[model samples]
Target: MPRPPYLGWLAATLVGLFAFVIRMLRLGEPGEIYFDETYYAKDAFGLRTYGVEHETVENADALLAQGNHDIWTGTGDFVVHPPMGKWMIALGDYLWGLLPFGAAMSPTGWRVAAAVVGALSVVLLVRLALRMTRSVLLAASAGLVLALDGLHFTMSRIAMVDIFLMFWVLAGFTCLVVDRDRMRERIADLTAAGQHAAGWLGFRGWRLAAGLCFGMACATKWSALFYLAAFGLLTVAWDYGARRSAGQRGVPGRWLLFDAIPAFFATVGVAFVVYLASWIGWFTSPIGWGRHWAAENVTGIWARLPEPVLAVVNPLRSLVHYHAEMMNFHTGLSSSHDYASRPWEWIIMRTPVAFFYNGDETTCGAANCSRAILAIGSPAVWWLSIAACLVMIGWWVTYRDWRAGAVLLGVAAGWLPWFTYPERTMFVFYALPMLPFLALAIVLALGLLMGRDADDPQYSPRRRIVGGVGYGVVMLLIVANFLFFYPVLSAQIIPYEQWADRMWFDTWIYGSSGSG
Candidate 1:
C-alpha cells in the first residue's frame, strides 16, 4: 500500500519504455542482413513460412526485399539450436513483414522481437533488484545500467537468438528466487504452528515456472544448460537451508523428501519435457534434417519393438541422436573467428564481436564514412562490476549473505562454463546472459556503501551522501559512455574518424565496425 513501491514500478517502466523506443530507433539501418542475422533472420522467415527452418538461397536478403518469399531451398536446415527463439523472432515477421504494414525483408520487422525482449529484460532486472533490495534507487539503477550497455543495445537490435537466451535465463533465475521466498515462508508458517517439520508445499508452482523458463533458455541455446544445472542445484541448497533454519529434525531427509525431490521434478524433469516439445516442428516435418536417423539406424536393444512403439520411440531417439551430433559440432567448433575472445579476456570485454559494419560507404557526407554495430558493454558498468563481483564474493564468504551468494552464482552459472571449452570459438558478447547479474552486483555493492537506512539514527549521513553521489556519478558516466559509443553500437553512419575514436581499445578497432 506504500507509495514508494508504486513510484519504483513507474520509474522502472519508464526506463524500460526508453529502452524499447531507443532500440526501435533506426532499427532498419544498413538495411541489409549481416553477421549472424544471415543465419537467424532467414531461418525465422522460414519458420514463419514452413513448420521448420529451411535452408535459404543466396541473395536471400535482396530476394526478400523484392517481396520474394520463396527463398527456402525446399528442405529443412540442420540448425543446432532449438526452435523456441526462432519462433519468437518469427512473430515479429508475422506481424510486420506480411500484411503490408512493413516490407517483408525490412530489418525492423525481424529485429523488433529482439528489441522487445531486450526491453523486457530491463523491466525484469528492476523487479529482481527490488526483490533483493527494498530501495527503489537500487532497482531503478540496475535497470538503467542494463539499458545503457552497448552489448545489450546491439544484441537487442539483432535477430540473433542470444537476447532471447539471456531473457529466458534471467526469467528462470528470477523465478527460482521467488520460489526460494515462497518455500521459506511456508517453512516459517508451519514451524510456528507447533510443528518441527514443514511438510510438502504442494507442487511448488514457482519452481515449475522456473523450469519452463529455463527450458526455453536451453531451447534457445544448449549453453543455457549450464545455468539450468547450476540453478537447479542452488534451489536444492536453498531448500536445505530453509529446513535447517526451521529447526526440522532430520533436516537432510526432510529436505530430500519434501523439497529436493519435487524441485527436481519441477525443474529438470519439466525442463526435459519442454525442451523436447520445442523440437516438435522439426520432429513432425518429414523432410527435416536427421528426422529419420533413428528409424534408419535403430540397432540398440535388438531393435525389437513393434512398429507402433518403434514409431513413437524413434522420434525421441532421433532427437537424442541430433543432440549428440550438435554437441559434437559445439565441441569441435574451433574454427578461427576474427572477433573470438577467450573467457578471461571477456571479463574486461577485450574482444567485442562486430555485429554489422558498412565496409564501403560514402553516406556520411564525409571523406570516409562508417556505420557499425559493435557488441560491448558500457565500460563504467562492466568495469565497476569486477569490483562488485569481488565484493559479493567477500560478503558471501565473510557474512554468508544469501543475496551475495545468489548474485555470484548467477554470474558464475552464466560465465565459468565457457572456460571449460578453452578451444571453443567464443566471443565476448557470449557473456550477455550474465549482464543482469553484474548489474545487480554493481547496485548492491553501491547500496552497501550508502550506509544503512536513512531512518536509522546510527547510520552515517556522510557515508550515505558519499555512496549516493558516487552512484549518481556512475549513472552519468554510463549514459555518457553509451552516447559516445552509440554511433558504433547502433550502426549509425558517421565519419570513420568518429567511429575509430569511439573504439577504446585495439581489440575493438580490430573488430568489425560494421565494415562487412
Candidate 2:
C-alpha cells in the first residue's frame, strides 16, 4: 500500500476541533429541556436510575428545575423509540450526578455526548471525502462546509438522537466506501494474474464494521432502516461493477451468489441481530412496556411451546408486536405541530423547527429581547446543495460516476422515505441524516469547479481562475450565512428587530409559527 496521507488526519483533526469548540460553547446556557429533549433527557434519567423508562409526574420538568429529580412514578413508560440512544444520554447523566438529580443539575452534561459525536462526524466526513476524492483540499473543504452548516451546527449542540443517528449512518457509509476500494484493488490484482475467479474475498474488515455501524443506527432510530436497505443494494452494485471491471464473464450472476448474498448477511443480518440485542434492557426489565405481551397471548401455538423455548420466543414475539404498534403510530400520525415541516420544503429549509425560545424585558437591554434555538439550515449551503443534487443526477446518468450515485443514494435513503409519510407530522430536524451527503454532493460539485489535475492540460489558466473564484465565493457565502444566523441557532439574546432581520421570509417565525 502507498504511504498513508499523514496530512489528511491533521487537517481533519483541526476542522473537527473547530467544530467541537463551536458546539460546546454555551451549551448549558438554555438550562431548560427543549423540544424532544423533554422525552430523551427524562428517558435517559429513567434508564440510568431504574434500568427502563419510568413514567414521570405530570409536572416533572417544572419539578426537575426546582431540584426534584425524583419525579418518576416507578411505573414502566411505553416509549416509542429504542433504548441505545437513551443509554448514550444516560451515560452523561450518570457521570454528572444528574441521574440521581441531586442538588447540582448540569444541563451541559446532558449534551456532552452529542457535542463529542458531532465533532467526530466532521472528522469522519473529512476522511470519507479524502478517500473518495484523494484530494486533501476537497476533503478538508467538505469538512469545513459541514461544520458551517447551520442545521448540522445547531443539531450538534443539542441533546438529540438525530445527530447520533447521522453519526452511525455516516460511519457505516465510510466503512462501505473503504470496502469498495479494497474490493477494487483485490479484483485488479486477480485479473492481472490471469485469474478469472476472485473467490471468497477473505474476511472484509470494513464491510463488517459498516454492518455494526448500521446496527447502531437502527438502535438509535427506526428510520435508519431506510439507509440500511439503500446501502445494502449499493454494496451489491459495487460488487457487480468490480467483477465486470475484472473481465469476469456473467458478472451479474457471479456477483449475486459470491457478493450480494454474503453482503446481505454482513450488513442486514448483523444489523438485525444488533437491533434485537439493543432491546436487552426491555427484555430483562420485569415492568418494561410490552414485556408481558407474549404471556398475555398464551392461547394459540404459543401455549404449546416448552417453557425454555417459550421464555426466548415470548420476548421476541412481543418485541415484534411492539414494532407493529410503533409503525402504526408513525404511519397514522397526522397531528399538526406548530413547527412541523414538509419533506419537499426541507431542502430549502422553508420551515425550520423552533427548539426553544424566550422573550424577556431585560435580556436584550432593549424594548424586547429574544433568545431562541431555531433548527435552520444555512441558506447558501442548502440552496447550492439542491443544485448539486441535480448536477449529480446528470453526472450519474451520463458518466456513471460512482461517486455521484453513492451520494444520491444516501440522499434517497435519508429523504425519499419521508415523502411516503407526507401526511405525517415531520420536522426539519428529521432531515439531519441527509446533511453529510448534501455536503458530499457539494464537494463533488466543487471538484468540477476546481478541475482535477487530469483536466489541467485541457483548461486555460483563465478558466481555472474563474473556477477558483467561484469556489471561494460559495465558501465565503456559506460562512457568512452561518454567522448571520448563529445568534438564533445558539440561543443568544438579541434585539427583537435584529432577530426579525435574520428571518429571510414570512415563514421564518417565532413561538408556534415560523415568523421571526
Candidate 3:
C-alpha cells in the first residue's frame, strides 16, 4: 500500500490526544494521595516552600490543607533521586495551590503533566517508526499499540518521575535519529559534488538538542544515564556506517576524528551543563542546605580557587553531597513491601503496585465494594513483545538490519541495567522506558508477517491474510483486556467479586483485602 502523506501524522496525533483525554477524564476521583504520591507530593511541596526539600510533620497532608504551608522549614530533607522531578511536581503545586481536599493534591493536578508527556511520546514514537520503516501503517500501528497498552496508560495517570524520564530519553532518541538521516543526506551531497572529505558536519544543532533532552532525562531519574551511554555509542556508529555507505574506505579513523570526538562534547558535556542548570532554584537560594558550604570552607583546595571558580565549585560540591545521600537511600531500600517487585518479574506484571483502593459496599452502593487503580501491563502487548524481541535478535544478528539494531539498543538501554541490581526492590512501573521499544518490536514483527516482495509470490496472498487476521486478533485482545480491567484502573466503584477476579495472583493482595 502506498503511504498517505501527512495522514499518518494526523492519525497518530489524534490517537495520542484521545489517549490523553482518556487518562485525564475524572482523574481527580481518588481525592487522596495514592501510593508513593504521599512521599513525592509532600517532597514537592517542601521543595517549593524551602528551596530544598524539608521534612513534613506527621499527617502532613492534613496540615498542608489547613493552610500550614510552613510544614518544611529551612533544613534539607534526605531524598532518593534528584530534585528535577520533584521540581516538576512542585510546578503543579505552585499553579494549583496546596489544598489537600482541593485539586492541588488531587490525582488530576499531580498527574496532568505526566499524562501530557506520555501523549506526546506516542506522537514521537509514530514519527520515529515511520522514519525507520518508511511505512505509515507500521508507524500508526506502533503508536496504536502503545496508546492501548495498560501500563503506559497507568503510568501516565500517576505523578511519577518515570514517565518524564521516558519522555526525555525517547525525545533524545528521536533527535539522534534525525541527526543520522541529516548526516547521511549531507554526506551523499558532498560525495556527489566530488568532495573527498566533509569535515566536522558543522555545528550539529540536532545532536546538541538531543544532549539537552538526555540531560533532562537524567535529571528526572538516574536510570536515564544508561540511555545516555548507549545513544552516545549508537550515534557514533551511525556516523561510521554513513561514511562507509558513501564509499569512504577509512570510515573508522575518520568517524573517530570527525564524529566521536566532537560527539563527546556535544552529548556528554552539554548534558552535564543542562543537568546542573536544572538545580538553579536550589543553587541560587541562600536558604537551601549546603548553599553556604563552600563559602564557609575558605581554608582548603576549594578556598584556593578564584572567586569565580569557587562560585561554580560550591554548587557542584553541594550537589555531589546530596547525590551521595540519595544513592545510599536507594541501595539500602530493603524493607519488604507487599507490592515491591524484582526486575525479573516486571515484564509479567507480577506484584503490580496499587495506586489506590477503597472498599465499602455501602459507599460504593454495590453488592460487593471495589474501587482501585493498579499498575498492570497489557498482557497481549507485553507477551507478544517478548516474542518479537527474540525475532529482533535473529534479524539483527543474521541480516544486520539497522532497524533491528535500533530496537535492541532501545530495549537494552532502558532494561538490562536493572538486572544488575536484582536484589534491589523495583516495580513494574520502572519498565516505562522500555515500553516504546517493545511496541516498536511488535510492529517490526507484524511487518515481517506481512512478508517482503522478494518472498514466494504464490504464498504472498495467504501470508497477508494470516498476518491481518493475527494482527486483528491481537488488537482486539489487547483492547478487550484493557476494557476488562479499566474499572479497577480508573478507580470506578465495582463489586468486590469483580475486583477479586482481576487479581490474577495471591501476591497482588496486600493483606488488607486491597487489590494492588
Candidate 4:
C-alpha cells in the first residue's frame, strides 16, 4: 500500500534516453540493404513516391543506392503485408525527403522512424512494468532488459514493420493494464457506496484506446489479429472479475449481456473498422491486386444486388479474396533459406537470422574479419526468460497470479501461433514482438525472489540479503551477455575468432560464415 517512488519516472526516462542514443548511433551503417529491409525499405520508398507500392527493377537496391530513385514501374506492387507499416516507414522518408525519386536517398533517414518507435517501446515497457508491480526498481529493470535484448535492438535499427507492430502491441497492452486498475478502483468505490449493480462502467476511454492500438497493430500485420482477439477476451474477463469482486449478483450473466457485448463493440468492432480504414489507399487504387476480382465475379447472385450496393460490397469481397491469396502465400511459404529456423528453436535462440555480413580482411582489419548484423538474442536474458516463463506458468496455475497470466497470454498470442505453422519458414527475428513480455516474465520471477518491499513489515532482513544479492548477480549477467553480443548485433567488425567466440552454438555458425 506504500506510494511508489516518483523517481521511477526519472529512472525510466533515463533508460529511454540511453536506449534512444544507442539505437540512433550509426543506424545507417553497413550502408547496403540487409535481409527483409529489402522489402520494407523499398515498399516504404515506393509508397512515398507513388502513394502505393510499385514494382521495381531487379537491381533496385543497386540503383537506389546511387540516388537514381526513379525505380518504380508505376503499377501497384502485390505486397502481402498491409500498407500501414510501410506508411509508418514512409513517415521518416516524408520528413527527410528520401523518397525513391528524390535527388538523394538516405537509408538512415528511412530507418529513423523505426529507431524512434523502438526506443519509445522501451519507455512504454518501463511504465507498464511500474504500473503492473508498483516497483520503480523493477520497472527500470524491465526497461534495461528490453534495451539490452539483441533481437529488439536489431529490429529497432532497421526499416521494419515488426518494431512498429511491437510499439502498437505494447501500447494496447498498456492501455488494458491501466483499464484493469481503473475498473478495480471503480468497483471498490461502488461497493463501498452500496451500489453493487452499477449498470455500466460508463465511457471506458482506456479500453477504447486499447482497441485503437489493436487496430493499428493489425494494419501493420495480420498476425496482430491474434493479439487483438486474445486481449479482447482478456479485457472482458477482467471486467467480469471486477464486477464479481464488487459483490454484484448474477455477475456472469450481467457481464455477458452488458459488459461482454459492449467490449466486443469497443475493442473488436473498433479494431475491425480501423483495419478496413488501413486499406483506403488499396481500395482507391485500380492497380491493387484483386481490385477487379469482384467485378469479374459479379455474375450469379451478385447481379440481383443494386449497382451502388455492389460497388461498396464488391471491393470488400475483393479485399477478402486478396487476403485469402496472401494467406495461401504465407501458409505455403516453405522455401529453404540459409537462415530459416523452426518455431521450436526460437525460444532457445537457435538458428538466428543474419541480417548482414561482410568478411573482407582489408575493411575489417584482420586476416579473417567479420562484420555482421545477426538477430540473435542475449543468451542470459532469453534463456533466463524461458525459465521465468516456466516458473510463471506454475505460479499462475497454482495461485492464479493475474500478472503472470497476462504475460503468458501475450507469449501465447505471439509465440504459440507459430507452432501451428511449423513448416512455414519462420525466423528468430519474428520473436521480437514477444520479447517485452518475456522480459516481464523474468522481472516477475525476480520480484518473487525479492519478496515484498522492505517497507512492508512482513519483509524479512535475511531473505532480503539473499534476494538482493541474487537479483544483482542476474542483472550483471544479463548486462555482460548483452555487451558480449553487441558487436554481432550491431554489425561491428571483429576478428573471425572473436566472432566465432560469440557463436555459442553450431546454429550460430551463420554469424561466422556470412552465408546466412
lDDT of each: 0.86, 0.86, 0.80, 0.86
As for candidate 2, its clashing pairs are 508-514, 509-514, 509-515, 509-516, 510-515
TM-score of each: 0.96, 0.95, 0.91, 0.95
List, residue by residue over 46-91, the lDDT tens digit for candidate 4.
Answer: 7777777778889998997787878888577788888899898888
Candidate 1 residue spans exceeding 4 A from truth: 1-4, 98-100, 300-302, 512-516
Residue-level lDDT for 9 in candidate 3: 77
Across 1-516, the per-residue lDDT of candidate 3 in tens digits comes to 225667777867887888888887877667667778777777777677767767667777776557455666546666677778778777865665554544564456677677777888889898888888777778888888888888888878777778788888999999999998899889989899987566667678899999999999888898999999999999999998888888876777788999999998999988988898877877766666566765776676766789898877777787777777679878877766667787767777666777788886456666779888888888888888889999999999999998899989999888889888866877788888989999999999888887654345555877888888877777788789888888888888888988989887776767222454
Worst 10 residues of 4 by lDDT: 96-105
Q: What is the C-alpha RMSD of each candidate to the true structure, in Å?
A: 2.2, 2.4, 3.3, 2.5
Q: How far is 206's C-alpha from truth in model 4 (Å)?
A: 0.6
Q: Kindly give the stretch of ten consecutive residues in candidate 1 with the minimal lDDT sum.
A: 507-516
Off by over 4 Å in 2: 1-4, 95-105, 454-460, 510-516
Backbone clash pairs in model 1 (N, Cα, C under 3 Å; residues 3+ apart or in different chains), count: 4
Order of the predicted models by lDDT, top scorer first: 1, 2, 4, 3
lDDT minimum window of 10 residues, candidate 2: 97-106
- The residue pairs in collision within model 1 are 356-514, 357-514, 357-515, 358-514
Per-model clash counts, in order, read 4, 5, 1, 1
